[model samples]
Target: MKKTVKILSLFLIVLTVMISCKKDTDPADKDFFVGTYKGSVSYNKSGQSITSSDGRVTVSKIGETYSFYFGNNIPDITGVKFEKSGDNNYVSVGSGLTGITINASSLKMLVNKDGATWTADCSR
Candidate 1:
């Protein structure tokens, strides 16, 4: 009986340690910065300009990267990479991309392609 008790105790201790040390992800980790945001948007191409106050941008995770779909005549941005810039902020990383910043409350985009510029300040 004592041998059985010792084995049981050892199993419980190992179980406790395994449970305590197991890696766990926070709520923020599962978020993946996916959401829809809306605000102001402006696009300028070939001397033609368009602006709107009800701009929208939807963010989603595709594989390992994020996709940005913009509204209000702004072009959609895809396959862009971002890295953590602050406590809840991320900045885009790539060439020919001026800047992209995302946070818990807002998403700002500024990119120029083929002399066309698209900018948006969105929130969710």
Candidate 2:
């Protein structure tokens, strides 16, 4: 009976430790940055422009690619790759003039690609 009690205690201790411990998540991971931000957003393409002061951008990630889904009928920017920029920030991998910066609380984008320009200054 004493041996059985010791084994049960050991199992309980191990179970408690396992339950208390959590895996460390990297800030650059998709789960850290996927959310919705609201603010101004604009898009211009081929002389047509759309702007909204109450715009929203929903960020989603799949594998290594991140997508920005713009509200107000603005076109979505999909399959963009980002590189870690700081402790908790990621920036789009592209030319210096047009890129995106994203963190836990904010997102800023100024991208011009394929004759379309998209701008956003949003925060959660």
Candidate 3:
């Protein structure tokens, strides 16, 4: 019984360490990025048939809970989460994520609904 208790204690300690490491490794401040981003995307399937739209995407950051949205008539889309990997690098997450890339001069991504990722240059 004593040996089993020691093993359990060690396991708990390892788990706590892992959780702390995860939090520390997320090395980006996702606070300043919450805003309405305007851009456009190109859609093509087989040939050069494509359509582009000037749409708006909004991001709201309330502490650790980040909510995102994008749409045409109404911004009904939500839960566009991102994991910031570098100084200006990110990717989307949710039921299905379309990659979003942000930089000093470019705010582009192939939206989740699109057949492919489209990059539309935007301004703050």
lDDT of 3 by residue, 24-118 (tens): 23313534334556666454444443434676555555454445455443323345566666676666666655566554444566564544433
Best by lDDT: 2
Indicate the residue-level lDDT of 3 in model 3: 100
Question: Which runs in model 3 stand beyond 4 Å of their true positions?
Answer: 1-33, 41-53, 103-105, 113-121
Worst 10 residues of 2 by lDDT: 18-27
Over the stretch 1-124, how does candidate 2's per-residue lDDT look in tens digits? 9999999999997775444322332325533335678899999999999999989998776577778898888988887878887688888885533489987677899898888899999887
lDDT per residue, candidate 1, 1-124, as tens digits? 9999999999997875444322331113443445677899888999899898987777765445777887666677788777787687778888766488876677788888789888888876
- Order of quality (TM-score): 2, 1, 3
- Clash pairs, candidate 2, are none
Q: Is candidate 1 or candidate 3 better by TM-score?
A: 1
Q: Candidate 2 — what's its lDDT?
A: 0.77
Q: On a 0 to 1 TM-score scale, where does candidate 1 land against the true structure?
A: 0.68
